[model samples]
Target: MKKILKACLLHSTAVSVSLLSFSFGVRAQTPQTPADEISPPVTDLLFGIERMMGSDSTLVETALEGFEEKYGDAVRGGDHIQGIAMTAGGQIVLSYSRQDPSKENCSGMLIYSSPFDPASPNRELDWDFYCETSNTDINNPPTGLGPEAHPSSLQASGNILAVGTHGGTRFYYLGPNGIEALHPNTAVLTGGRDSTGLTYNPVDRRFYLLNSDGSTAVGKNTIRLCRSDQDISLRQANQAIFTDSDCINIRDVYVSGQGANLIVQEDGTLFLVSTFSTRDLPDNLLGFADDNTDAIWGAYGTRCALETALLPGYGFRASFEDHIYISELDFSNRTADLVMKRDIRRTQAVQTCVDKRPAFRFAGGVATIRNGALLGLWSGRQNPPLLSLNDSYEFAFQDLPQPIKSASVSEEKAYLFRENNTYYRYTDSQGVDPGYPASTSRNWDFDVEGDDKEILGAVRYDNGHVYLFLEDGYYSRLEKDGSTSPGYPVKITDNNWPGLAPYAERIRAVINWGNGNIYFFLENRGPFGGTLLGDGEYVRYNIAKNRIDLGPRSIEGPWGILGDYDTDITAAVNWWNGKAYFFLEGGEYIRWDIDTDETAGPIRTSKYWPGVSDDEDITAAFRHQR
Candidate 1:
């Protein structure tokens, strides 16, 4: 046996199984060590590797206990948070303006030693060291980002921290010593265009911005997607193409606020947040982008928002008034909670207009980080896969739609079902029927409950009606007029169908071969009784005989095309076009040549269906020939 044996470290997904085999003396060896030095045995080394790979530790974030008071202490009259970002290591960076109306003013950035304990902040740094005022020293690099500075933006991805100013975007390297500015040569100069809100996308390796439309007159803000990392100009920034029905000027100038910020998700969905809003868009409007069509920020843009940050597992956090909200993605004011509130009066409380609201101290700018990086997003994964042609009418599937559970085709329309009784009435030429992807009602007069309608498999039989295998071993038939056929939806029993009664509850898909036969694929229930490796099998029934003729064969053995995924077949469709399709888990389907019996593909459902995610599986499929 070669010392470097297959059973040693070559386990694909069965590392534990191999280890057990090796320990039982199937082929155990001591193995090699680093530098030929004495080291632990093979078991010890492999166990260490397993422990390292299975590590589930995450960065522990401290509560923002004293964030508000700390903000009041660091800032004085007219100072407000400008931008904020967090590194992958949970380090925080904040930028703010110290511009007092009476003075030239100053703006500066601060780096916190993560989970930001305001009491200590960064152990190595002091607030007095970075912020110098124009009143005291105008020429020297005294404090802040320089005298008379208006606003600056910060973005941290992994160890790379970037700052945006009129001089352009400056990069920084974060080390044990703290953040150090990179050389001017590495800086991406933006021709004095101070990107009010700056973010770095790790996936695309580019910087994105939130800036005002050249007309500061209207104060309209538009997203600037920097095409070139080094050159972020107007031409490169303007990439928005609105829908035909949308009001361009309204959506462009919709959301306006101080210290506005932006955060993009991995799939190109972004949120444009603001500290406070005066004109346009509501509050926390969701933003959508069409990267495939080069149409960005069209209609799905948001309303009012604050500095926002997305944590890996804890979801998004946004501060409003005094409370911070957390949700999977819900930034809406209605459902979001942390539903706390507090307000501090600045100066003296006076009557009428004299009592101007103080600038919001929290969410000045928000960002989340991991692995010492920005944990960037906007990877350009288009969910809708929306496309536009020479323009008659453009169409695409809705984003993140759930996968269909079962489908049946008729002469004119096809019916598709999802969980929660949602269904889509689809068509071939006109695409999906309007007012579909709707929910089916549980108002059926049958004794069956609501869940009993969930379709497990479906097929348009040799008869004129469509047959549906429903939940709880029940079945139904639909007429051409979209109404349930009379006296239908009965439970499956050995009396009606002989051999199928035993496996009726396990049927995953039902198909009509069109040659006077129906076939069924019963789903595997996991190694039968939990002891055997019992894979599911397909059964063939003869419509002429009204009974199962030949069946109970191993799915993988008969259909060599299934490979190692015999138990994973969720749906089967016999296309009217001389092809049979087998749908598997995770939106992948293979084409079977009925005549040749050779498999053509394991193609992605998204490749043909657009909106289906790779993780969404097809439960059942159908097609009927008139």
Candidate 2:
């Protein structure tokens, strides 16, 4: 492995100067000792590198004194600073955010330490120093925490501090030492309650901002993202609002210049899920360059959930036409593969399930497309568990909306599903009502039926067929037409399903890769037969060979799961690129790869939308199909 050096220097002095004079292009002076020759402690070596990279001699000397004052002999031993990250270049940087009052000011400080060598083997110098700052505010603002500066994310790129704060999103162009706001103040994303999940797409050279669920001048709980990296004011920020429907909470957005998609998952009973985009339109509403606005134009979002889903080349697909997919807890199994296109010729196109028992269905999380596919998660569904999908409307293309409680997608035609338990696939089983008033076009119904009504999981058409996986381990195939193929659901054994662990109660979720495979999660019970029997376990199912590979269980015995298993599974899984990403209750985010057979993380966090944790009722994420 090639060794990289990064150093931090804390200066105990006040230094505010011009940016050009203190930029990153400082000359590397020939010290008495060569940096390549020193074997000093990593800390000292890193500190030395900072000094050498820096051009300010006064700042360097001051930092050295501070280092000596802080760590006497330890400075030579190099044992501090827990985390480290490097830019594509060799520039070393460190990040720490503190809302606590004890550090400098309430405004959190981000620091960068240059090359500071403790012993210069080439120059005969014993130690080199780097500079640090007390107040690292943007535009040299005051000591208080403001909206623009309460950074949710802080990254250093070139001479810029890429900042995405709760207030608005903007960048601060800083030299090696000083701060400069890059764009006009009015062009920033400073109006929102929170701005997070920011990405600086090098391909497009634009900064993407995912806004939190809050009120804007137009409505409440909307999703907005900006493409301009230099805009400092919210007004100038070219933003696309994903979900404009009333009370839609858009969570965690991702964008790539190749395509634009928004996933909106609401958080209440009948939670509205939808996806919107401008890619498929014939011409721009406000005409500009057709493909420019078609491909690279400014802000716009739509409300057609079905059109977003059926627009075939959507996810994991190479071609792109905007699409949507939705996952809802089916109290009555009648809501399977049901789609009601909004048209005057079709009445009874929309199918509604009247639950005999009390039920709660909602959306929890969603992801927009950037490079590969768009995905959304629907939770709090029963039987089939959670769901994942490439587009929200894929399941609803026909009259019987796929009974996916929850789902997420990795790419076009590839998907994951929860709460599926059927062995038959239905396609074009019913047609739109030819004789209907324009007022009742959405009231159409499809003619399809099977004992396999519950859909535990599904993968989009990789081999020209939408592969459906059920909870009971049944597999069905669906084609473009509304027809059904009574295929056998691939069953997983106790060794494969693993939920049969001595104390395990049931399997929790499943994801379908575009290829012929399925990944399943099992939640077990406690060792002593506690209220909750076991923790969650994972498994993969091979459709071609018909085999299941189970894995070790989780720490939280899976029996007494977080929410009610009677109606909702409370989790979702998605496959992206070649990896499977799973989101579950108790706020867990996990990923696994089939080819690599490696799992990434089980990171746990709460819901991105507010009011989700308050009621303890389950919340799901699903994209709305227009």
lDDT tens digits, residue span 321-428, model 1: 211111111212212112211121211111011102122222233343321111111000001112211101100010111111233234656555554344555576
- Please give, for residues 241-311, the per-residue lDDT of candidate 2 as tens digits: 22222112333322211111111222211111232222332235555675564232222323122333444
Candidate 1 has its poorest 10 consecutive residues by lDDT at: 1-10
Off by over 4 Å in 1: 1-412, 429-436, 442-447, 450-452, 525-532, 611-615
Query: Lowest-lDDT window of 10 residues in candidate 2?
Result: 390-399
What's the lDDT for all of these models?
0.41, 0.29
- Candidate 2 has an lDDT of 0.29
- Candidate 1: C-alpha RMSD after superposition: 22.6
